[model samples]
Target: MTTFPVEQIRADFPILQEKIRNKPLVYLDNAASCQKPQAVIDSIVHTYSHEYANIHRGVHTLSVKATDRFEGAREKVRAFINAASTKEIIFVRGATEAINLVAQSFGKSQLQAGDEIVISAMEHHANIVPWQMLCQQIGTVLKVVPINQQGELLFDEYLNLLTDKTKLVAITHMSNALGTINPVKQIVEAAHSKNIPVLLDGAQAIPHMAVDVQDLDCDFYVFSGHKLYGPSGTGVLYGKQALLEAMPPYQGGGDMIRKVTFTETEYAGLPHKFEAGTPAIAEIIGLGAAIDYLNQFGMAAISAYEAELLAYATEQAQQIKGLNIIGQAAEKGGILSFTLDRIHPHDIGTMLDSLGIAIRAGHHCAMPVMDFYGVPATARASFAMYNTRQEIDVLMQGIKSLIEVFG
Candidate 1:
């Protein structure tokens, strides 16, 4: 494994240097969103200060420079995920918009009534709600594959759910709530055997590990930029070139059109067909910079270091009395979720904040996962590339102090 350089990584993010409530901030809410590095911030600032212009279809110097950066970002996204081509990468608001684009453009157009879409029990609501909306609109069926008590997806059961009528298999690459990394390559292979295309919600997985969409053989992959240390309201949708070409544009306007007339209009090809109107220009450029920053450390080093941090946190968290860890999957990322006896998760979050220890305490937009675990909510401490074991120790101290206060 390559040297992680955690301290140097921490230094890249300016926010990590601050003291919250007189104590150093121990940010453990990375699964929600990561703090931006100086590089990403500088990229955004530079774009706005010097190269601010609407992209594509302008010949002015600023427009040309801006367009180059915008298109260059698209190539960066393609390389980041090892996508086939820049044509396969579409810019959207975030993963939510990306999934909806697939559901509305692809799902609605191709799938007929009674066609089934297979998803897992551990999916984020973004994955679930779009399909539900599609079902309501088109009379399709949504089949959920169950998970074991450990929050791992039941592969055999998932296979059984796929049949002649199953149109697509849409699932998460990693669970934001539980941190369980699904067997995506296997999932894709199984879905492919039945000629079913698979879409993996990669918002949680992209930050914690390296993902190659080509290797996984997933038909479509979506993730939020903010989750990967980029700006909010910017994300990516990577689809197989053939699939993207076949699907109609999700929205109609602006850059998405090839030619528009009074009566007949032709849409743009590939990615531009889906990206309607003006996009978040500065944010997208910042995303490119964020990817550049991650590449500096190498994702393999970051993943290895985060794994060590997760294991250490899990061990320390399990030792605490009255704390019950949730989602103990064998294959997990750097997220630790747990419930404390006699203490509401909200209270834990509130108390932790007082000590400059930040953690998430809620359904994490995966309320179904919470219902499965028989808990209303869980306190989650998610690690990032910049986090240290010492931060985990501070979190441990906060939890112990909370438990004593409740008693």
Candidate 2:
């Protein structure tokens, strides 16, 4: 087993101490949502306890405090992705809303009849649906880049699909279902060469590895805070300042507008233009704290540790009889999705739960990818910084028990 302070890391999350069915809980569903640290929880509680007030409009002490806390979170987000300016960060509900915002504002303004938008076969529904809606609204065409049997993107196929008519390319930085880390820099360069803008769905990538939006030069980058060890109902959308300035406001509300009259109104600038109404103030503050927590342990260290865990898990899992590991990408994150012969994924999930081991078993919101593999779903066990090789051993034991019971 690779050396990591797993016990110390487990202590940071209080919920790991709980018992399930008289057994110690082993949480492997970090991809769906991570267990929040005490720091994040304390931040939310502290915000609600003391600094509860509406932001931006009020000039009073409480409002000023609220505004400072709220905008402070924005700066944290800006720095997290290495965005060009605070103006580039727009707070939204989550990655779902962020993609929808781009589809609505930028899609509406730029996409025209017969224009084409490119996406990958491994895209989540959140990334695919909004673009489909846009294509349907206008007469735009939606094209998909196929993935090979190894669950890696066919970059050559993607290149072939690119044409002068391609308006935008919306691709995931990492595949949520397959754990494939895409070559986003190369993808962005390819799209830019065609003069087509690209938007990266970064919800999965941000939590696992380092992401530099400026370095990638993607037109827009988006992620959710909940998946990054922060609060739910809070996410960020980072668009180039020039692109945001050109697009219209996503939602019309009090804060998004600069001046309003009976006849006409003027929308606010970049960040505020996209963010409408009273925002999730406490959750935003909690996200800032979560970022601070991640920063304490550098992303490089976290990535290296997770890579070791993934290799150990892969080697151990391969030793099991009749086990089939899915998505064998040359480059991968810490997600291990697999199937056992003649056992349904849901059944495997339930059996593992009986052993106090939690793993996700479903289509994982990428039905198209499942269809490609000719399976309804596969059991997924994703790891985080807190996960250790011993946990993987427990998972393997649980799987063996499940097979013995079912077989």
Candidate 3:
């Protein structure tokens, strides 16, 4: 009986009070992006209203205040993931941009022609596309480890894929569409045995569970703030100090230079070298506030609570006749994806929306996973800390109504 302060958690998110189509909003699209709590919202407002200034290169009062908040956010991110230093935390636009940065900057140098980068079959498009682009440019080959029908990675096949030619192994810590939690620590150990670097896309993992980069021993980790109940256009990329020093700058512009000249320009340090332009300053502060909000409840308790919710949803889902559930990985996060016998996913989403239940429908940016399952799309209901089992019951009722309507 792991207890959770469910009602108190729900009240913190003002948007939960929203009424959609005259029905109360039941938000279950957490894997895409989580709803912000009032703390995060207030932080964003405070940053914009009180301390809005470009970070670094400015010695003015507001600039220093803004830079403190911005860099303070970086420190929060560092502590959140247990990174060694603030130097390793490079704020990017989102997980998409974070992966792109590593691919162009680190992958370019580490991988030559005929080199291989290994990824899982269930990777999101954000994880897959950048490596493909890198391979296309450098003549490197991308290797994909297959997944079982349960959506778990084939570990033996992954081990087989790691040869001397393997340069990097990039994988998602959790599958956004499938909710499958990968064996990342084991994956890192296997890759390291071959002297291969590994990167984790933590966009789906951070909000649901506690993450420690040092314990995982992954060379790089990336996550988006928006998925962690923060704001859009804000993300964090964590790289080892040694790797970041060796890698070239992802982009060259303001704040990334120690000294600039007509002949030879000197680049700045680890993090600034990767961050090329003006960042999402206010959003970064909001992200720090989001971290604060989560810490109050603690991730362990949240994970436990969500597990109970997931179990309830899974058990209830089985009772719906003609409903086919996808991604039955034994160990998973709180995501439920399904397809009704005669209903398109888009229609399912629309019908659910009319009842004020928010769930995602489509390929979910993991077209490869969808193709593997032989489905065009699925309706996904992803849970957050604020979600309730009662909401799941409403969803079941809505789904049953759809079956009756279709019949």
When summed lDDT is taken over every stretch of 10 residues in candidate 2, the lowest stretch is 1-10
True-vs-predicted CA distance for residue 80, candidate 3, Å: 0.7
* lDDT against true structure, model 3: 0.94
Candidate achieving higher lDDT, 2 or 3 = 3
lDDT (Cα, tens digit) per residue for candidate 1, span 73-139? 9999999999989999999999999999999999988999999999999999999999999999999
What is candidate 3's lDDT per residue for 217-332, written digit by digit as tens? 99999999999999999999999999999999988889899999899989999789988889899999999999989999889999999999999999999999999889999989
Give the lDDT ranking, best first.
1, 3, 2
The list of candidate 2 runs beyond 4 A from truth reads 1-4
TM-score of each: 0.99, 0.98, 0.99
User: Candidate 2, residues 24-128: lDDT per residue as tens digits?
Assistant: 999999989889999999999999999979999898988899899999999988888899899999999899999999998999998898999999999999999
Q: Candidate 2 has which clashing residue pairs, if any? A: none
The true-versus-predicted C-alpha distance at residue 217 of model 3, in Å, is 0.2
* lDDT (0 to 1) per candidate: 0.94, 0.92, 0.94
How many steric overlaps are in each model, in order?
A: 0, 0, 0
RMSD of 3: 0.8
